[model samples]
Target: MTSNDLGDFLRARRARLRPGDVGLASYGARRVAGLRREEVAVLAGMNSDYYARLEQGRERSPSPQILDSISSALRMDDEAREHLFRLAGTVPEGVRPRPRETVGSALRQLLDGYPNAPAFVLNPATDFLASNALADALFSPFESVDNLARMTFLDPAARSFFTRWERAAEAVVAALRHAAGLDAHYRNLHDLVGSLAGESEEFAALWSSHTVYGKTRDGKELLHPDVGPLSLTFQTFDVRGASGQQLVVYQAEPDSPSAQALALLGSLHATRHQGSATER
Candidate 1:
């Protein structure tokens, strides 16, 4: 985490808000977009100079009350507010050892249970630790299913594979930011973010926005090379006894077209696997 992450987050969130967003009247043509520094300070009931010092990184330590005021002024959501506290270093820190990336045997068995669905395991940094056969087939279009962030922003196939490409991009970046906040000292996470920011402009821009979110349950629209269009809903579960590991399972509604498509994809995947094994 950079020393200026807090400031950058504050600036980004401030830029997203308009004068009228906080019940303030717009008077004349403003030089910058959204609320100005002074305006934010005013909303927070603090002097602009203090807020300026905080934004400029001159003020390193801020009290919880002050952070709360800033969070309220910026109209941050729960995740964003927690992230703000983390960046400001006002939240109590605990000893969080780096989590193992390996998925357990039981989890592997669980993933296998979803024969027609795509189920995979992901680390905090969004690395594809392990995936079931169906999940592998779902992501077969990518050259390598290494990292979701890389595949989403850097891969050519992602644009076509993800029907809502923009939303997917935003979501992955936001989830990464959330992970960074929780696991601040994880070196691999830092390296992943740095590499992505250097490679993809869109990722860099979204990262700068400081949008922090964790995936729990979400619906996705996907266009598979083999199966064509599919609408799937996924649920993410934190794996017990595995720190920073999440199990994601994607399913299509029963008796729906998407379900039929998923079944067909599974059949094709099984046939290919069987043929490969027979050849071996």
Candidate 2:
């Protein structure tokens, strides 16, 4: 969120490339890692001074054509190329507003209709806006299932809950990075990143790496307290009316052990809810 974020990102990414990586032969003794600023400029078909200024915060804006050239010079993928444009303030026109935090009642109802699947409504910051009973049961291991990023990094149980903790942590950080790129002024996301970075060293390191990725679909392995192990795949759908809200639903492979475990977990949750209602 600093004025130098663009410069910092450029520096970080520049350090990731080597002369050989870009088909440039080593000519002399190199002082630092990756391609030099001049090399990048040459590759991008621009003056070295101009590219250097862009990386030094002296240049605030660059043309979309220049950004596209730089993107190719860096060999960036779709996600990284998009992030570069955002940093250069060359965002495409017709960009939608930031997604809302509230989940619609109809969406909540839809989540509940998935009795077997675990579904939740989430914002870009990974806040659990709403969830179905099965989803609640799925995440019941944590003391509070508030935000996915917070739970993954701050909670002691996360290491045990996610079978592949490292992957989970990286994915969470990348998603947050992507979200941060979308809206730098989003206060909740700003606060969450600050808190996580201050408390968690891993989070700080990953955030500094400038990795950006958005979640679409992914498979997850979880170690539920009651069910032992569960393998599930989740799909995230952007809410039609809400710009930032996402409906995430997790489902297990049919007839698999994970499917059976999910079913049993659902039954247990239902039984407990009924018992609580009866007691009341």
Candidate 3:
């Protein structure tokens, strides 16, 4: 990892955009790839020399306002914008550093309340901090589901488990990329990305794209050995006290076949737990 990769990141993002992408008319022969330096400066409402300095790593401390402007000019998403702020050595306003990773007892109880819903908590690095029984059942097919990105990219079962494997893979990689950028100094995350990049070609290709995003409110289609196929919608909520942890809940449509499957799975899980207690 370079001590200052900000220049490389900025240049890559800039090269990804075209003159027409930022509402600039494309006329005459243009030699430069993507938007020119002057074009970006004009769009960002900053001086070309200053912007060039930023790209050259000569200007290390850009104000939040300027970073925000550049992000806007580049059509960056929320995750990309956050990454830009981090590279500038400043946190964006209203964004706080992630707190310690701890899922409170109350939150665990809340997960219990959702017996029909598959719920789990994940740290910023996608580590499985905690999970409900249904969530356990849902992910039971995987040999290991400790890290979501690993399971998605490294596990062969993931191909079948996630019906839309490509989409799931992309989302997982993007989220991990987002986290890694924000906490570049995190050794574990660096190791995780390195492992994935080395082990999975798909992961390596996507990682180079530098796409970043948090989990979104989207439905997932899954295939379970016992239940066959399931369609579930998932929502992610930030844990009140835990900074970088999020509670993700998966729910099936009411009275639908997927819901019925979940109910059956819940019953099976409960029976197994009761039997285990009885044996003890």
Candidate 4:
């Protein structure tokens, strides 16, 4: 909740980023491991001292323009940039906002329509209980699991579900922090994250660095027991009736082997379930 947390995040991220990541030429014999403060300032088109001051919390409010520049310099995507604004105590500028965030009907219907691909609707806090049959099949690890933060941090099986467990875990932690900014009073979410942090060292390290980000349009490689490997792309879209809810749609690339694999999983699941039902 304090500015120190935010400052710590900025410093940590800067230190970890490589010069090559942002296209900064290494002229040889460099002192710092990553880009220096001055180098970042140059890229962001800001004074080094001013950037430092902001990082130190000496300066509080930064304009949208400056944030945009800094976000670009840091190679932040749209999801990451919006997350930055939220982390910096800036609310979405507009008309009236919602008192409580919830997903809408249309998006829910859309999720249901994805018969083969896995999909779900999530709020800012990344709670992903809402999903269709196919999504449930793909994300069976969290099916009927109301709390995503819990599944991510608490569940031992979660580590085996995702190919990039570390990256996924960090993203969830960062997302929770971002949500906390928008809804700091979310006691339930706060409690869940706290409990997970207590148990998992991986989560604890990520929590120390306050990285905030929204959902990015990316592919996830999931190894289904029946399907073997399913390559899926997740895309987020605005929910018309939901204020903070974003529709997360997942699909396999058309005509790809992964798509066939997904179909096989679906067919196998249906047959198995139906057979059990007949026996009962």
Candidate 5:
């Protein structure tokens, strides 16, 4: 499943379509299988023979305009279009992904003062920016490195760390895929998703299904080791326009065990560095 996968994936997706899905009607065809190459070519704005070559894997690359046409002919929604672009290696035009940045002292203090909630910042690539102690304790899977996408796909502990791992995993992948669509030159992101698709069967399964999504401002839950299941309301917002950085805030379920876990996490963050006493 390398870059060559682009041809096969596109071919498979095309073959699965029924005529009705693309606003086409059957005109009494005795066909071998699926939509005829000519039909798809007409809809996709490509030569019939050339479209056949693409489907047969004899031709791999297609121009952006052609791909967009094919996407439209296939009735692909925006999410589907983005996923198609990613597979076809067409980077979205004029997209410059902002570089990573260290959170400011003020932001760090804000996280520090969040006694009952967890807050962290993420770069465009979904890497951790600055996690407060509560965030650290709750999202401990991220402790090793800055990457959230990698952690979701590659980290061994993350599967167990996140409650509803499958859903969480999908969210991470979908968000990353959206970002990838916005910037095809997000080479690092492309590599990360590729690596994960190769390494994790779970990722492979979900990615192949062509699901796409963005981060929302609500409905998050994490199963903390010390605190059990902690549901939280979450929100994300732009923090720096120049950097394209986002501030993500997490709030525990009110009056739940998660609140206690958050308090414990704050204490842990506050004291663990000093080593007066410690508990995990």
Candidate 6:
């Protein structure tokens, strides 16, 4: 375990939050940014000194109840709350198994069936283990699409590809944070974080905020090179019997412009694949 990692995470998170964010009034000039240490204590229903101790690394273990209270005070989502527990070296019982990196043959076949939609499988660390042709075309601009988080933060094309790039970046970082908390010993995740932190100041700032989240059904807007702008809905599903693997599928509403764009992207992918096969 990295010494003081918990303290560092707590301090960073605290620094990013504001008094007004937690329903507290800002009455006077404040020297520091975010909620003061005492304010967090008050909101969390804990002693100020004790909360300080936790942030200062003097307090190592906090009860689940206390952690829950603190998580609430911090306005943490479910994933972020779980990350807090993990940082304290006490994950709540019955946590699901961490997803593995491998994508099974059955899953690959399922993805192949989605000719129009873009679909792929990601491990807990956001590694793209397998993707269908349409999915490949969707992310074709990236020099490498090995890791979604890395691509979002480090790839130049990401800014254009994701119409709302800043929001997309935050979501990616939060998802990575949740994954890191789930498996701190994941070497690949550690390396990926280290690399992104070193290379991108934006990524570093977001990572320090210690936010946590997971992908679910959501709308995404992207600028595709071949098909122009696309507005699509994406849904992520847990690959049953495959720990730490999630299958993400992207689709557009019927008869929408996005649907037409998707069709064009599919045609382009098919043409390219056919050309390559003929050459071989």
Per-model TM-score, in order, reads 0.97, 0.94, 0.86, 0.74, 0.70, 0.92
lDDT of 1 by residue, 1-280 (tens): 5769889888889999998889999888888888999999999999899999999999979899999899999999999998888888765667665778898889999999989889999998999999999999899999989999999999999999999999999999999999888878787789999999999999988988788888799999999999899999999998889999999999999999999999999899999999999999
Per TM-score, what order, best first? 1, 2, 6, 3, 4, 5
Residue runs of model 2 more than 4 Å from their true location after superposition? 27-31, 92-95
Runs of candidate 5 exceeding 4 Å displacement: 1-75, 82-97, 141-145, 268-280
Stretch of 10 with least lDDT, candidate 2:
87-96
Model 1 TM-score on a 0 to 1 scale: 0.97
Per-residue CA lDDT of model 6 for 1-280, tens digit only, reads 2477787777777877887788899778888888888999999999999999999899999999989999889887777777889989796534756557788799999999998899999987789999999999999889998999889988899999999999999998888888788888777788888888999999998887776788798999999888899999999998889987889999999999999998998898889989999999
Q: Which candidate number has the best TM-score?
A: 1
On lDDT, who's better, 2 or 6? 2
Off by over 4 Å in 6: 21-28, 92-98
Lowest summed lDDT over 10 consecutive residues: which window, candidate 5?
Answer: 1-10
Clashing residue pairs in candidate 5 are: none
Which residue runs does candidate 1 get wrong by more than 4 Å? none
lDDT of 6: 0.87
Best candidate according to lDDT: 1
RMSD (Cα, Å) for all candidates, in order, is 1.2, 1.7, 3.0, 4.2, 4.7, 2.2
Q: What is the alpha-carbon lDDT for the whole of candidate 5? A: 0.72
lDDT of each: 0.91, 0.89, 0.85, 0.72, 0.72, 0.87
Residue 59, candidate 4: how far off, in angstroms? Answer: 4.2
Clashing pairs in 3: none
Clashing pairs in 6: 99-243, 99-244
Candidate 2 residue-wise lDDT at 254: 96
On TM-score, the stronger of 1 and 3 is 1
Q: For candidate 3, lDDT tens digit of each residue in 239-266? A: 8768778899999999999999999988
